[model samples]
Target: MTITLLGVVGSPSPGGRSFAAARALLDGAAAAGATADVLELADRPDPEAIQRAIEDADGIVFATPTYRARSSSLVKGVLENTGRGVAGDTRAPLLGKATAIVHTGATAHHFLAVDDLRDVLGGFFAAQVLSPGLYFEGADYVDADGIPTLTDRARELAEAHGRAFAEFTAAVRAAPAVRALRPLL
Candidate 1:
């Protein structure tokens, strides 16, 4: 199955660490045979446009720069607005799609944001969130080349998540779609 992976980078400013991380992660997804694209939300985003992108994607890589102690408010707004739109349209727009979270923070403590996101995406969006979300603390700064080169460990983890996410999305695509939350027969 050919899968399209969409990376949405949510940074309050352009060229932030998380923006670069998202770009790097998209490269990893493309390397793993996914058709990858990205939407960097630095400008004023239209809610309808965000909803359309989320609806059309086969898989999503949600990357954000941590703010205070959480993912960027910009990212949260996108999710909240898109989630509300899709839920009203149908119970789950991402019923079988996969989503992976990547965050860049000031310290390892920022990694906690991934768990918060996983719950929101899985419980609210009905996304099959891939395991072992990625986080890079402080190291990756976007250079003049606009590349977000990750540390050895972070690079390995990002590539692994990409490969795993692609495989999982393909698997889910092949399976039958579930129409409702019926009890197991």
Candidate 2:
């Protein structure tokens, strides 16, 4: 069975490297036999829209670009919104869904952003998170040809994450307890 994935792009810049990273993961997921959709949060700042989208997916991949050593405010807002009650369903939809992260930053100085995200997600999301979130230095996305693509390292990581998430989501779907309940976004 195919699982639905929602990839939230948090770059806030049109067609930037962070956008490319999210696309690469979707490609990897597609190759792994899963269907995917990308939510370009940069284009839409509405947290309600983001929360609503997450409700329909089986897993989530958060893609962000580090700004001043942290996730952009837009991504932070979206993450915060996920914790709120929706549609008389007081439960956070993200509670049961698998989540992973991929991020890009200009320098090693910003590398801490990846772990910071992991900690934040882990604090609220816990083992639902995949281990060792993927990280790419911003320069890695650039090419002499000017068309951006994932680095070999990134491609490897994306494939692993894609495949694992597929399995993780399937297990979530098979749990007897939630069979009668709405999906955890």
Candidate 3:
């Protein structure tokens, strides 16, 4: 079956590390026979549209830049506006769907930002968040026309993660039990 993976980029900048990583992941997912696309919060997309995309997607990749040792305000704001409750009847649309969290930072000191996002997406929303979420440091970038972009290694890693996530999501979606689990909420 064809699965759809959506990348939600929370970077305020149009084409930063987070965006590049997300694009690479989506590219990998597409190569793996899944449909993929990225939506940017920097464009000020409508909340309802974002929610709809989340609900329609089989899996989601949340990409954000670390700010103040945590996810960007854009990411938090989207979560806050999207849904509420913790695995309750009114749980977020992400419940039971596969998810991966990707964050970029100036250094590795803020890696725990992934944990914070994981707690909310997995613990709160009850999504099947992929483990060992990705983190990109400044050193992982390379100079591209005087602008920083993801190094080949970082892009490869992100793409591999995306392929695995897409395959896992497809398997989860194919199982009747997994699909039923959502309605049990």
lDDT of each: 0.73, 0.74, 0.85
Model 1, stretches more than 4 Å misplaced? 84-92, 140-148, 177-185
Task: Please write out the lDDT profile of model 2 over residues 76-123, one tens digit for every residue.
Answer: 988766663345647476755667788888766777788888777656
| Per-model C-alpha RMSD | 3.5, 3.9, 2.5
Order of quality (lDDT): 3, 2, 1
Clash totals, every prediction: 0, 1, 0
Q: Indicate whether candidate 2 or candidate 3 has the larger lDDT.
A: 3
Tell me how far the alpha carbon of residue 2 in candidate 2 is from the true structure, in angstroms, after superposition: 1.8
Q: Which consecutive 10 residues in model 3 have the weakest lDDT in total?
A: 176-185
Ranking by TM-score: 3, 1, 2
Name the candidate, 1 or 2, with the larger TM-score value: 1
How many collisions between residues are there in candidate 2? Answer: 1
Q: For each candidate, what TM-score against the reference? A: 0.84, 0.82, 0.90
Which wins on lDDT, candidate 1 or candidate 3? 3
Off by over 4 Å in 2: 84-91, 125-127, 144-146, 175-185
lDDT, candidate 1, residue 63?
91
Write one digit per residue (lDDT tens) for candidate 1, span 1-185.
67888888898777677766777677777788988877888876677877777777788889998777687888888866653224245424555567889988888877788888887877776677887788888764434576556766767677777888788777766665632322111
Worst 10 residues of 1 by lDDT: 176-185
